[model samples]
Target: MDSMLKADTADVPARENAAERLAALAYDDMRRVDALILERLDSHVALIPELARYLIEAGGKRVRPMITVAAANMLGHTDMAPIRLAAAVEFIHTATLLHDDVVDESGMRRGKVAANLVWGNASSVLVGDFLFARSFSLMVEAGSMKALGVLSAAASTIAEGEVRQLSAVKDIGVSVDTYMQIIDAKTAALFAAAAQVSGIVAGRPSDEEAALETYGRELGLAFQLVDDALDYGGAAAQLGKSTGDDFREGKVTLPVALSLKQAGPDEAAFWRRVIAETDQKDGDFERALDYMHEHGALNATVEQARDHAARARAALSGFPDNAWRRALGDLADFVVERAY
Candidate 1:
């Protein structure tokens, strides 16, 4: 906790629109990746393309694919293979989001109605499967078995993580370690793979590949931690989803877990009723927020996130001092700062 607090106070200059800056740095490559994504989404089945496009066209940061292309470029690779792989990473991410919205029963995504809400759950699921298949095809075309294996394993791990999270939901007894494992598998695995595969395709050394993977993994953890904190504190429009969605869904996130650990008898009963029993009342979400703040749960979670963000920035220290690496470091800072 001391180390996390220290890291949280360290100077990391905030950037305006950090993700947008990263996107701009990788703009040309991303343009190609976006084109390739649209091309791959094409199908003779009109409904297939229609559903996939509906979500793809809806604005999102496309951060995973940005990491893929940026890492490759940072490694000085000027080839089409990375572009193909970047597009593949985007497809994988998009597929996961589609599946996740259904699983989470989310009504909004990226400020638009979730695909599952607009289309049927069945349509969203099938389209997600279709996008997943397209991702594999793109991975195969990229001509790197190691890269393909990495992405495939990530996809599998994500499913396992989701299952793990589902099993833990409404179980207020979940530890911080267990919660970390869930986010690592559900969110960080793909970010790691997205960065690692770039080095694989670039034919970089094992150490650099390891570094990039570390950067992505830590960044992903920070990203999710901040998102969890935001669910309680952020505006719905800013989050592109409803605040307290996690509460309503009975998902036990880090803030909730921390608050539960310090709960007095009355607070314990409150948590159990809202989370374990899923018997939430009108003011329950507000009360939960109050408990989290009283327990310093949100700050603790943000401090942990700041530690991870610092580690993510440090992972890039080994790379050459270049625009790519600096942007990545800034992005890590941005991940934690967004919670503020």
Candidate 2:
């Protein structure tokens, strides 16, 4: 397991590592946005503030907020609105993570103990609500009804997607279309909103706004697909969670869906029984993985992710050639390359 983890980790590339990639933007602005995120996250309530702070400090890649900033900069907006929007996006995202941890009964996040694990599910859920409300307040401060519309719709879509995924749990007959819908709503919607809101805030042309939205949606879809793949392929320690955690939870993801579709009758029956019964033994996960490997479902899912990455890159064609745009492309590639 350790050797496999090392191998996978080694294969993943760092996103936006080159200094030249970020040279177009003023580092001072980026630092300012970082400070803004911290400052806006503050709350007077003792427990909520502490718990929210714990989750914020848990070291996410901040990819969604970065997308907002990059998109705004690409559209020639260097104002504080972008910074506030970036922080707003992060707050929304972090709230979702808190709720997600409770739903998944997750014990760890980004190699640290999860808020729910440390503070209990009730506390985590309430703090998540606080963040959600705070996110909307921040958006209101942005003073754009268009921005509010986009973000509010995204939030609703994400909820619907979560509910859809819950309905599909342990159901082996879940189709690729269903899987795509779930991911598009749950994962890609916020990315689309983030980029679109940035464009809206910058008063970009309709075409530019559409392009940014497309880029964000495709990038987010690809990111989640890679994440689902890693959940099965990654090491438990490196993932900061258990391997086959999704399977154990009876969550049907893309790779598993494809594998089920391709499985022989006996293998299909085994999957149905294990999943329906929620009786996942070590051998059950191994068998499911072996079937996925034999049917090339894992590779198929990876190919799909690569296709989305290509689409995301193509969406950036309308943007001017600049360091930020180039770095956005690099970031898309990194999403597919990350091991966990």
Candidate 3:
């Protein structure tokens, strides 16, 4: 832990909109990627395109795809391959969001009505599948077996992670190891693949590929950790969902998991009733937040995210201090700072 720097939340030093800064840094490349995304989002089946477009155009940071482009630019690749791959990454991401909203029973996505609610679960799921297929088509267009293989493997890993999370929900006995595995697969896998595939498209060496993947993986872990911390408070609007969704759903995030480790019998019993039994009532969320703050669970989660953010920054050390690398590092900082 000493290897990673820690700052008071107020001293975290991120600008008001680090994401906007990142977008500005990569403005040209992102515009190309966005253009490609709009073009590839089309479908002959009217509903398919419409539903996918609704989510695609919905205002998310496009963080993961931007990572794809940034990695390519860091390696000095000027081809259109990264653009195609970035669009594919976005499609894969959008597909997962659609599927995840249904799985999480989330009412909103990107602050808009969730696709599942708008189009029905069946429609959302089938459209997710269509986008997934479309993502593969775009991956094929990228023309790298290595890139295709990594992204395809990430797709499977994401599903496995999602299933693992389902099993972990309400199970207070779940270890931190299991919890870490869940996030690594569910959230970090695609991030790693998105960056690693950039190396493939750029014909970089294995070491650079591994480093970029580490950057993405650690960044993903940090991103999800901050999100977990946010669920206990009023930042749900920033996260594009209602507050207390994780608590109401009985999801076992790191904050909850850590708080469980320190619980007295009474606290443990309360946890079992609410999480294990899903028998939550009024004041339960407040009680859960109390436990989290009492145990320093939220702050501890932020520290862990900061550690990953440090690792993400370190992973980019092999690259020069160019705008792309600097922006990538700043993005890592932004992810952890979001917890504040």
Candidates arranged by TM-score, highest first: 1, 3, 2
Candidate 2: segments with Cα more than 4 A from true spot = 1-27, 234-242
Worst 10 residues of 1 by lDDT: 1-10
- Per-model CA lDDT versus the true structure: 0.87, 0.80, 0.86
Work out the TM-score per prediction. Answer: 0.93, 0.90, 0.92
Model 2 C-alpha lDDT per residue in residues 1-340, reported as the tens digit of each score: 2232232343534322422244335356667766877777676777887888787876676778888888888778888787778788888899999999998888778778888989999998898898899888888888889889899899999989988988888888789999999999999999998888889999988888899899999999998898888778831213344467788888889888888787888987888887766776668877877787787777778778889988998999888888788878866765665543
Could you tell me the lDDT of residue 186 within candidate 3? 95
What TM-score would you give candidate 2 relative to the actual structure? 0.90
In candidate 1, stretches whose alpha carbon ends up further than 4 angstroms from where it belongs are 1-15, 234-241
97 Cα displacement, candidate 1 (Å): 1.3
Best by lDDT: 1
